[model samples]
Target: MITTVTLNAAIDKTYVLSDFQLGKVSRIGQIHAVAGGKGINAARVLHQLGIRTLATGFVGGSNGDFILKNLDQQQISHDFVKVDDESRICLNIMNASNGESTELLEKGPLITEQQLAEFRQKIVLLGQQSRIVIFSGSIPAGLSTSVYAELIEALRKTNAAVFLDTSGDGLIHGLKAAPFFMKPNEDEIAQLTGKRPENETELVQSLHQLADSGIECASVSLGASGSMTVYKGTIYRVRVPSIEALNPVGSGDAYVAGMAAGIYQELPIEDCLRLAAACGTANALSAHAGFVKREDVDAFLKQIEIVQL
Candidate 1:
């Protein structure tokens, strides 16, 4: 079993418009709402790939009710702890005319100390049974940046591999726990290393330097340019063939899902990168978050190229 922890989950709502103009009336072509947060997104993708996943986190109020129902409709198993505060709603507005997207995110409900203790207990129990325990997304209000570090430490007795995906202080603090894998962008990588890479050469070098800190694998997202990763003391560059992307949101989460799936399956490092990139590309080609038709993944899997650098 795989356990995903989303400290802050939301009712992710996406709106599509031919042209989204500020201070002007524009008709929306479509709207969709689903359970969301980085961990939730990854769990959805994992479920789509036929992986057994249990999503655990804090949820509350009517908004939390909506999230649970959405998960039930999708047949995804979730074990969320209810709280007094309401969960958040995240909005994604896409403008087809400009090929741009604007996001309005909500800082989720603050968690009480008692709620934090309850959630931490859940994490330790779940981690013991899970093969991979993924901790993703931003830390909500009323929580310190070191919260993940503490949670990770609590699960240190378990054999599950930890996958940490976060930015800023969350990522920095979580490092002390030494996650098995980490996926950070270029800027976040620089922030950690305290040096800005001048070019791709420096970027790859930075990735190598990070691995030296005891992180087994470090994968860096390069957006449309694909990604670079270090695994088993080898550096590789991943590239995906071109495809018209309807919506690129959640691609990163999809990538994490694929990587986790690969790790769970004990695939080769190259195959891991191949699967990860394939899922990310498939997500970009979809109109929704955390969804990729199996056929689409199969078709795109062939176009992905992986090379050791």
Candidate 2:
């Protein structure tokens, strides 16, 4: 089983509009409220892929209850630690007029020290049972950036592979533990390496730097163009097929889920890159957050072109 950890889970509310005018009223084209957070998304994708997954994390209050109910209805098994404070809500405003999306996010509930310890214990117990543990998204307040790093170290002893997808200090600190896999978009990778890839060769070097840091596999998303992954000192570039792109919000999360799927199956390096890039492209063809259609993924899987760098 794969265990996904969402330290700062939220109820993702998406509002779609034909066109959004500045400081003006806009009619809602559609609206969707779903269980969200990076790890939650990964779990949903894994479950859709017929993979047995257990999602564990911190949640609280009514919003938290709503998330649990939704997951339950979806038949996705989860065991989130309950806290006194309320969890957060993330709002996404997608303007179809110009194909743009703006998001407003809330810092999640401030977890208490006792709550922290309980969640930590939960993770360890769950990690012991799972073959892989996925750690993703931002942490709530009242915790240090080293939380994931510490968790990685602790879980590594259990022999379960760890994969992470997060940014900023959380990612910077977590790298010290050397996870099995990490998926950071191009900008995040540039921020960490202090170098932006101006061309394919530079990009390959940057990915190599990450793999040299001891991460078994490292990947970066290149928005619409595609993505790149490095494994065991080898770099692979995945070129995504062009399609009518709708939204790019959750594609990165989908990519992470695909990577987890590949690792769990022990797929070849090229196949791993293909699956990850295909899943991301599939997610972009829809307006939903962290979602993808199997038909799209399968069709796009054949369209992906992977080249060894």
Candidate 2's error at 260, in angstroms? 0.7
The local distance difference test score of each candidate is: 0.90, 0.89
Worst 10-residue stretch by lDDT in candidate 1? Answer: 190-199
Q: For residues 46-94, what per-residue lDDT tens digits would candidate 2 score against the true structure?
A: 8887789988899999999999999998889999999888989998999
lDDT of 1 by residue, 1-309 (tens): 999999999999999998898999988889999999999999999999999999999998899999999999999999998998889999999998876889899999889999999998889899989999999998888999999899988989999999998888999888778899999887888777888777879988888888888889989887788999998678899999888888888898999999999999999888888889999999999887788888988887899988888
Off by over 4 Å in 2: none
Candidate 2 backbone collisions, by pair: none
